[model samples]
Target: MTHDPRTALLSAALDAAARGWHVFPLRPGTKRPALHGADRCRTTGDCAGGHLKWQERATVDPHRITLCWQTSPANIGLATGPSGLVVVDLDVPKNQDNSNSSADTPDGATTFKALCERTGHPVPTTHRVRTASGGHHLYFTAPAGIRLGNTAGTLAPLVDTRAWGGYVVAAGSLTPGGSYETVHDTAPAPLPGWLLELLQPAPARPVVPLRLPAVNGSRAALAALEAECAVVAAAPEKQGNITLNRCTFKVGRFVAWGDLPRHVAENAFQAAGEARGLTAAECRSTIRSALDSSLRKVRPRETA
Candidate 1:
């Protein structure tokens, strides 16, 4: 016997809950949620609450899934940060055609691929979901110890990350834009360490001085720089190369602000990459590419 499409969807939601994913109901044919009064929801550190919006109360309970879907056929939306998973959301590029098809060769995918290639980072071959607009959702287990935030263009233009304070429509959801479908059979892979480092905000660190100053004891600060050097020096093959570049670029900004002595900072950056096993030539080339611009172009820190 053919199962009702709505029933199949409800069953799918239950299956997701079984995988320890919290889910909420979305409108039948759109990413817009089906929760009532969701717009009026608010939360605070001391207290949190929402209006009728179901997202304020998404659940993983099988019973809750049944109650939600049975009440009305709804799309499935996975809350990202709350679920400890992050999704790389490659959105379909805009089109004047308005052909009404979800599938298309949008700029987001191309940009993402180029970024991966440039970073020497491998695109994940793990669990993926195909979005209606020909975009894709690459899912990964959030790395421990870093709070990743949702961002657009943090990685590349048209590419977005859904982490804390964000959500992604699940694979089984149907939207007027299109239906989400699983593209890969495997479970999500742990997010790559190099990528995690890139996603995380850089720690606030003062630049190393030309010589130890008698001004004050900041031995701890110097040690932190040493640790950063270690990470670059030991970065995994090509994958870590981009991270090293990014690290150097951040340091260059400090140099631009006069927070770090340029000569001292450069020597430290070179040492870090070399320590991470990079050849002197490789380190020199990357350091130049990454730091030259910021030094030439960045403005000094602004006064309050």
Candidate 2:
């Protein structure tokens, strides 16, 4: 079978460990190896002599040596698949100000630290450089029974440690914009213990019933209403400009006036009413009155 470079690299590292060798795993972007104490490999198959020696020294605990790949680098090219390794994507935003004076801490680094604290795991001292994008890759040794999986959308598996990827630590997950700060390998502030405790567990809330209005009793009226709604719902996209009412109308699955663009859909109802010999203004006013009545029914009354 043709050799997969990533798999080959991992297999060699594992084999070296089995033979009482200490292996240090590294990634492409950064000068520092993700697994410290080992130097970069010059080629796909070649390991620096120092790294080989370190691997030999680590042979007593073969699990010490691990390969970590960056799966969620902003630039797609350098992202890698999980090879039974523990990959932690530190999704830092590009606009993040790394300067210490800034009031806001880097969301990604803060989140990473939080995860480590919560899990009672020591954070790795080293990080991998991502291609072009400012995100850093951190790899941690996985707790037993977790193996990394394949890439899905923007997410990729880190090494073989499945437990590590796809978790959203509020701090580490990137915002709508790309920017984050590095909390690893620096004199960062301690993560709040209270936040970690709150994350531990919480009670579930009771579910509330959702009530929707019954459709008009007349089949002909219901069909006409449905057709009118369909036309109004398609209007925004058809016109190539979005209005608040159009947006609301589009999101509503049911033909409830409350769910629709009140004024726009009301106008359509008025037009329909006029065509059917009812006064346009009266039809519109009726809908407004119904909406007001429904709103009052749903809301809690003020207590004296």
Candidate 3:
């Protein structure tokens, strides 16, 4: 007995919907969304009031899933945000790349494994999918009230993540390469604490206003410089030098525009970084380097 392709696709959508994942339709045999874009919206149905993107419109209702897949042999698209999933996509190098050393190039799986070993973490076992390109997707449940955005090469080279603004071509989808199949039939594990630490944004630090004596510059420039110095002074522990560099670099644009003098900016940053525990030498070196780079990159004031 042979299974009808349409029926198989419908079953795939329903299965994902059953697991509480919000499901959308991918174009037949591809990972692209089948939904219309905002620009193409006709102000009808779901978009009567405003356009709903694929993530906003993804559904977990079994009735909607059945009705959708019955019309076409569409692939299943799992919206990671709505489903509370954070999927790590481990991908192989593209087949079209003709580099002679391609065979030795580390793929996402290899890099991710090395990262795990270095961090003293075992490769997390979770609900996994083998994608058409022979890559893998490891699904983890996102922590409540935390929304993570998609990342490319942030965790490790070749490793990408799909979260709030992303989706994954789920198991049972097909492409020219092959079919995506469930390699591990299990519930998704909660995202690891260590990984969560890496993904979470740094906590915002409170900046106590800097009271600098009168300086030679526009009032706007003086205020901006003071605020930036306060940010450096309030940087979290062990982050003082990095914060000093960033803040000084921002003020450098004003220097380039002649809104502030370089000496004044440098002097203020030096004082702020020293107050925040950075060595005088470290503060001077970082401030000089940051300003140099910022000045070099800044466009002419008129164009800017």
Candidate 4:
């Protein structure tokens, strides 16, 4: 039986809607939205697949999906965020938008490869769509109260997330390059704990300076840093997060002594804490509390 591509896409659209994903219409045979003539693409970024009012227009209504497909077998796009999806879009930039330049950009697959190596955490198993550009759209359920964004190159250079301001071309959408096909049809998986933390912005970590050590001691400033950080990293997995927090408070005492610059200590300790299983939130809270409470209001001492 020769499968009708348009009919197949329509069926897929209904399936997605039934699963609670808000759906929108993409231009036929394209990954772009089926909107034009002053009612067109006003939003940018990952919204390259949709429009300014894409969210408002997205629907789970069967009547709307049928009407859209009847007009034209428009490619389907799934609106992210509101329905709790955040797609990890892996892009392979083949050419500049304005020019026919075939300059090579870091493709999504390669970036994802690098990320696995750096973080020592593998990408989670999840519902996946293969893009026409040979990229991937790994869908994950968003955590409550956390607003993720379309970030590129920070977590992994070639990776872009389709979140609050973006939409992903649905599995059945046809692009000029090819169709967005499902690699995995199962339920979308929860975002990994580490990844969820990585996606959010780093919180403010301020350190207050206090009086310097009078003798400064036989202990080199860096030696103290090295020792305190070792203690944090060596914390046992059982109650490890608590141990790291207390060690951080001790390190904050060093910051107060001006032996360690706030940024340097925070970065070292954070990297260590993550390696030891502290969530980003846990690490930040500990560091901030330590910085706040560890330093005393004593007067400065004379330098030797």
The C-alpha stretches of model 4 lying farther than 4 A from their native spots are 1-4, 36-52, 96-106, 205-304
What's the lDDT for residue 77 in model 2?
16
On lDDT, the stronger of 3 and 4 is 3
Q: What would the per-residue lDDT of candidate 2 be over residues 1-304, giving only the tens digit for each residue? A: 8744444344444543453323343333222233333444452333434344222232223343332312211111111222223334555444456564544434455544544554456655643333234545553333334233322111111111112223211112222344223344332222234322221222332333222235433454345455744443333321211122232233232234243444544555444333333333333433443334334434332330
**Of the candidates numbered 2 and 4, which has the greater lDDT value?**
4
Best of the candidates, TM-score: 3
The TM-score of candidate 2 is 0.24
lDDT per model vs. reference = 0.69, 0.34, 0.84, 0.71
Local accuracy of candidate 4 as per-residue lDDT tens digits, 71-129 = 67789988897769888888877654537764554577776765565566776789989
What TM-score would every model get versus the actual structure? 0.61, 0.24, 0.67, 0.60
- lDDT at 158, model 1: 72
Compared with the true structure, what per-residue lDDT tens digits does model 3 show for residues 173-254?
A: 8899899999998999999987776566545434455667677788888988989998988887756756887788888999
Q: Which digits, one per residue and each the tens of the lDDT, describe model 1 over residues 92-211? A: 667725678546433777767766766677676778889988889998889887678877655654778888878898888877767889988577888877566556654433433323
Tell me how many clashing residue pairs each candidate has: 7, 24, 0, 1
Which portions of model 1 miss their true places by more than 4 Å?
1-3, 38-56, 96-106, 204-304
Model 1, residue 56: C-alpha shift (Å):
4.5
Q: Candidate 3 has which clashing residue pairs, if any?
A: none
